[model samples]
Target: MAKAFASQGDTSEKNISFTEIGAGIWAFTAEGDPNSGVIIGDDSVMIIEAQATPRLANKVIEKVREITDKPISHVALTHYHAVRVLGASAFGADQILMSDSARAMVVERGQEDWDSEFQRFPRLFEGHESIPGLTWPTTTFSRSMTVYLGQRRVELMHLGRAHTAGDIVIQVPDQNVMFTGDIVEYHSACYCGDGHFRDWGQTLDAIRAFEVDAIAPGRGDALIGPEMVNKAIESTRDFVRSTYQPAAKVAAKGGSLKDAWNEVRAVCDPKFSDFAIYEHCLPFNVARAYDEARGIDTPRIWTAQRDLAMWEALQN
Candidate 1:
């Protein structure tokens, strides 16, 4: 291969930041790596989007400890992606929550995703050995579920599919701060290998309708006011559209996947080449965009072998 596969070459650690986006809402971000959210409620704390490993999750726990001693009673996983859910055990939360569709995806492709991501980004899985196994949710809701962390009312809703079919967002009504898991990103590239390009904008619209005051996005910096929040949402929308439009046009004209890839690059690179994880996510994003444009509704499960094979094909 001409280049390292995915983020395998990115071995350097990133500076971590634990920023408070709202009164009790915190965003634990590591440069452009996956982000985790902490919502300290009246009596307990709720975590959103566990990191890739127990070692990483401990980093978030350390920051949470700096603020309050409230026991973390619940963990809400927005989706079933290995990078986001595998580190859940570190929280020791009594209740692990997820959308019903997310749990189903875990049953279908959880192990495969773990293997695939572990190979793709070795740096993120710093302590893979410590991970017991796939993280399973103790409870799941079909559409929307409300959880009360003492007096704090947290709403988990499936706005629509964007980053993945089972993506859900956590909203704090009192604070008007939403924790959007991969559904919304600031400056980071959206990993769309398992995404729904068509429904992504609609999902963003749903989140926008709320006019939330703050947002703890899946990656990049925590968006603090209405202006920054709107900017991130629109930029994310542009990224998704720019990626899919060129590829969709190529597919419409019966072009090969390689052709679609070049077309997508032609459109996306100039605008988003500087975004975090741009190169790492490009090949997978292009492949999925091509598939979706060709009428494939569901994303194909990505195994370790498939990841390499796809990367090699794109390289050639």
Candidate 2:
């Protein structure tokens, strides 16, 4: 039997965990689902990665209320995926922040991406109607920006592009904790539908330079300790390299995209089959890697129509 498209069959709810990995830094993880970060400063809170909808974000808010009553004053997005940014309204943050390039992506393909993602993963958008349409950042920076929540300092830096052209990491320099959006995944599969494989590897190297005690990834459990941190980064790099290299090899041989897709699944599935969303991401990952290997640097927009067509062509 053919597999379900994307995450359509993934209706089971995951157990959420709120872990404190640093001084006032919390990681809100939901069993390999989209994860969030809560940085409680001396005065207020800074949220990283809004959930898929206002309804879903409320759960995170409830968790926050359990810890501190400080109003959430800021939100930082790592990239422009719908599941990550569409829930901004629930936070009531004065400053919704992202890299300027991420803002450009929102302008370029945000609507199509929203449609595509919603169609691909209906379970994630349970309260789709609550979404106030496309989310835009109130503050945009090019390279890096620093914010002070009273005495605590949070640094937002574009470490280099990986998951998206404008991926950024929120670093609590003093605490040595990093909230890496989708740039890195632990046991969860890396979603590379809009990724730059070559650039992603280099970006991982840059992330390795940081002396981190804990990391809050886009998905998966909070990685605590330098050992686990290195493992996650290396595992993420391995996933990207392993997926792309085989597809690139096939493309270089002038193989069909379908052939490359099959090749990637054969090689990757054995190693990554148990990872979260591994099945949902493989087709898109293979498609993007095929395009990139064929010298297509920029990823094509994935509208809902394009999504179905590509899935059918590759998987059916």
Candidate 3:
């Protein structure tokens, strides 16, 4: 079943494209907005990456309704990001799954992340009142966990740190479909505020090692073929490199954050100018890049006040 949804901003229905990439598998994409993927197994369904709000998650459930009425048995959070996990209740899954590191992040700064993200991206959280509470994973693993929904194999692995300390990817072996949470984005700008720039590159390499036919990334379009998959992976790789090198140079030279931001804009803007959310991500990305360059391990907590201060300092 192929369907499309057009919102107010997306006058063209083509903005959102839903496709059955493999047997009993689907990718729900809306331009560069957040994306969700579905896997219907022998008896139950696994909903990956709950959308930012219940309203958004409904859009995913609507498509699942078209194919099969199997109840949502499990909900998986690729990492602990407010926009990703806060809507877990909407899925109504009996068990929620995530990496151990992700669970730790939730415990460490879940409240601050919730408040900070809500303040930054109200568009993603339309009906905050519906969010029951902070989502907690019922099941968590250290490195790799293989889940069996009867016969379908859903492999969850923590390859390396990328978007967040707990960043993980979902691989459907039979379908050859991989759901790379925020580890790999299609055309959307890579959000690195809580990312490890060095470890992120290795994570990308690990993701590419899998034999994937299609990919449902955390954002942007659903990559259908190997070509498109490679393109997305490389695009993500480029974003990370562009951010890291300049920040590293600034750190080496004892240059200020402002100077590094200037260098990054000079390099990245010319190439990634048309990417979605490029403007919104650059400030945050640069801030994290600067921190990593300065040898700051474990990203600093981002409160709303700190976010505004950084935005004002960098953007202005």
In model 3, residue pairs whose N, Cα or C atoms come closer than 3 Å (at least 3 residues apart or on different chains), thus clashing, are none
Q: Give the Cα-based TM-score of candidate 3 against the true structure.
A: 0.94
Model 2 Cα lDDT, one tens digit per residue, 163-242: 99999999998799999999989899999999999999889888889878999999999999999999999999889989
* Candidates arranged by lDDT, highest first: 1, 2, 3
Descending-TM-score candidate ranking: 1, 2, 3
What is residue 78's positional error in candidate 1, in angstroms? 0.6
Span of 10 residues, lowest total lDDT, candidate 3: 1-10
Off by over 4 Å in 2: 1-3
Residue pairs in candidate 1 whose N, alpha carbon or C atoms collide under 3 angstroms: none
Task: Please give each candidate's TM-score.
Answer: 0.99, 0.98, 0.94
| Each candidate: RMSD | 0.8, 1.1, 5.3
lDDT winner among the candidates? 1
Q: Residues 177-295, candidate 1, lDDT per residue (tens digit)?
A: 99999999989999999999999999999999999999989999999999999999999999999999999999999998889889999999999999999999999999999999999
What is the Cα-based lDDT of residue 225 in candidate 2?
98
Better of 1 and 3 by TM-score: 1
- Quantify all predictions' global Cα lDDT against the true fold: 0.94, 0.93, 0.87
